[model samples]
Target: MDSMKNKIKLLAVTHHDKKNINPIRPEASQIIGLHRSGEVDVLVLCNPGSILIPYFEKEGIEVLTDPLEKKLSISTVLNIRKLIKNRDVDVLHLFNNIACSNGATAAIGTRCKVIAYRGQTGNVSRWDPSCYLVMLHPRLNKIICVAKAVENDLRKYLWGDKSRATTVYKGHDQSWYQNESADLSDLPIHDDSFKISLVANLRPRKGLHVLMDALALMPEGINIDVLLVGADSNNEKIKEMIQRSTIPKRVHAMGYREDAPEVAAASDVIILPTTKREGLCRAVLEANSYGVPAIVSDTGGNAELVENGISGIVVEPGNPKELADAIVQLYKDRAQCKEFGVNAKRRAVTKFNVEQGVDATIKIYKELTK
Candidate 1:
């Protein structure tokens, strides 16, 4: 308490997804960054079994083992209320919808400031009563959006001062993606084939069907192979889509692999053909971090991540022909593909690095605390 007296007190509560820490790490790491910065006394509330628990302990961060109850759990709210009062918390930073709702409720009648983290776009409406419990709540001091797309979407429904919502991209260190690419020989992809990887669940919004459309449209003997990672890749519908496509054998759907980064690293290029409401695709970021070029649809913040014609290609969403054409451009020019890879990696390190995000988070804290 003596050591922390001069610093801002930050309490961040979020569930650490055990399946993949990549998406959640940026949020977690910034808390560590704030602690390291010596400007904030950080506390974390997460699952007890989180892989990050050891790291939190190592850093001597005060840890609380509760995800803070999802959506108005009474005990969770009371715990948060008690922590705000007892810890003299300055900033209550909540990640995810459940935390935002519960954390805001706890902040009522308290002097503590609250910040809500928005990771995606849509699924919110001013007309929706549930949204009022979360995003449209009047008590929030700020809304930390993970991308410009998310900020814009959220601003559409904010009943309070719209300026409270700000876009600050969740960033990553390139070092986290430096793993040796896994062996691809186990799969049917040929040695000479141009590998294109995608690391999202096979779903409509993810646009697996649209990506399949482009693959089917590729001319015969193009030597392109697709690597599909994440869940539901082996489901009957996905299998049927592949079976019916022209490049039936070329698409390999590997469901939820621990070695996903390694698999993506082995690829010649990455693609996210997401159709709508994407905040930012972490798969594209992972590939870019690995010095792999990407071809993403022009939906949401895809364009922000991939600098079109420099780092990678951006095509109109749901347009299989444009996606196919973009793929062909990269396919025909291996040199250009490699160049894009270099630029992609450079973009990640220069603009979207973790330090910048941490600084942005600190700026928000300073403003709220002042």
Candidate 2:
């Protein structure tokens, strides 16, 4: 075992911009935890004035801003190389595909071990040269998948090595779920209406349209209301769909609520009927932490987080009928919902807590550094 005195000097890189007030990704929280625990001397490399900068700085962690481009730019590579050389970075932790490629290139001649964090289950196009460069890079020593499902997907690729890659579920700060006095007074909800919440970015892959389709197919006399809480990605398409739908009055498009935990608390059941697989569904985890059972599609890490018919129901992806059936079933049986909620909360607290994630990640860092 490495001595605590010889902490690893880690450089965590992310391509995410500072668009929102708070850090949206799990990497930020993990870095903050690592720094505070004295497990790693952490420095974050991100875009200029990135939303992450303020958050990292508030925690007294150092941040470096660089224009990390998606394409293979010489300047980006050289800058990263310089940072690695000057800082004596023991490990380069990359959070995105582009950053992984650039960091791998930069670490070519250095002793720094490259660790790529794969958080999405989307398969890389075989024709994309950059994907090959990033995934199969000789400099990359470890691939940290956010879920077992993601790791399985990576193994299908030519460059993915089962021996080198491992799953590490992203953890959440339990504090985010500790909103006992959460008030959803702002949302439109009647005392008699059953609320179903879908908290994700309003995008095609998130399967908002599929969820809406399920709602349209919902059996009559269900008396259900849906709260769509996320940033609008497809303009007013969702709104327009709601307006023209059979239950327009029952659906509320609450765009990008910062109080997501509170929103989950207010809802009876949470759902994520995504068509595409995710690295892991953080929304589902958050809802589970708040003791809200979810109905997620059997895609990506959704099934991993939600034990089908146990913690929550797992319906087939892109199937409106199945989604609708699951929703209706859960709605009809309140006891099952309560039981699932209890199990979900137990799993979230016991297995998916931020402390557990940090400990796993720190162990990986120690293994690499040693």
Candidate 3:
């Protein structure tokens, strides 16, 4: 073990403006935890006057609000280069594509090891010059993919040095599991109702239409309620689909909630019927931590998180009938659902805890720095 005298000084950069919540928050929290534990000295670089500034400042983590514009700004690069030189940063970790590109460029000729966190499974075309340049950037020492599925896609499409890519599952703090569930009594759902939650941003690829179709096909006697917890980007389209469905009354569109973990705790089971591959579903992991089983589509790393017929059920992607049947099966067999929930919680605590993810990342940092 390295002594406190040999601690690493790391800087994290995110492209997200803090008006709305970003996926990078959880990782930021983990980094803050590491800072608190005296494992590393950390600083965050984000947009000027971002909402996240005060939030991190309260916890004593340093924040640099250098306004990074849409296009690569030379001024921003120079600012970052100056900060790196002054702080003697050992590693520079970037959260998004823009930050990765810009930070890698700024870290050129410096001792700072650049590590990029990739959380999407989308293919990068060689035709896209920016994607091509970022993938082949020589200054990039490590690429931390959020899932094996994402790493596979990155290697297949981006043509990078495959050895540099490593899979590091995103982790959730244990406090999410310890917190009391939110009071959802105001909703139309009854105590006896089988509550199913879909906690993802409203997107076409999320397959909410497929879920609506499945709900429409359910038998008349099924006592179930669906909670949609996310920002409705395609509000009109989802409203139209819900309006056309037979079970419109049973579905509640509870737009983005701050108490997502509490919502998951109150749910009997979680569902993600995404048509496209996910890097790794943080929602599913959160649900699992709450001892809620999930019925996820067999795409990307969904299958990696869920054990079919054990922790949770994995169904064919975009297949409403299969999804409906799986829902019905779990709803009918409450005992099985409970069993899966227990198994899911066990797996989550042991395999996907925040500390585990932080430790893995620290190992990588030490490796690169050494």
TM-score (all chains, Cα) for each model: 0.96, 0.90, 0.91
- Considering only N, C-alpha and C atoms within 3 Å, which residue pairs clash in candidate 2? 18-51
Clashes of 3: 0
Task: Give the per-residue lDDT of model 3 (tens digit) for 1-370.
Answer: 5584588898888766645543455776667766776778888998885666776788898888877775477887888898889999999998877787788889998989999888867757767777744665668899998888888877776454777888887877666568887778888886599999987565778988878888888989789988888846358866776765588788887887877877888999999898885778888888898899999998888988999999999999999999999999999999999999999999888888787888888999999999
TM-score of predicted structure 2: 0.90
Question: Please, what are the lDDT tens digits per residue for candidate 2 over residues 291-333?
Answer: 8999999888888999888999999999989998998898889
Q: Against the correct fold, how does model 3 do in TM-score?
A: 0.91
Candidate of highest TM-score: 1
Candidate achieving the largest lDDT = 1
165-246 per-residue lDDT for model 1 (tens digits): 9988877887788789978887888768899888756558998888888888888789988888874654888788777557
Off by over 4 Å in 1: 1-3, 67-69, 231-234
- Could you tell me how far off, in angstroms, the CA of residue 296 lies in candidate 1 after the best superposition? 0.8
Collision pairs in model 3 = none
Clashing residue pairs, backbone N/CA/C < 3 A, model 1: none
RMSD of each: 1.6, 2.7, 2.6
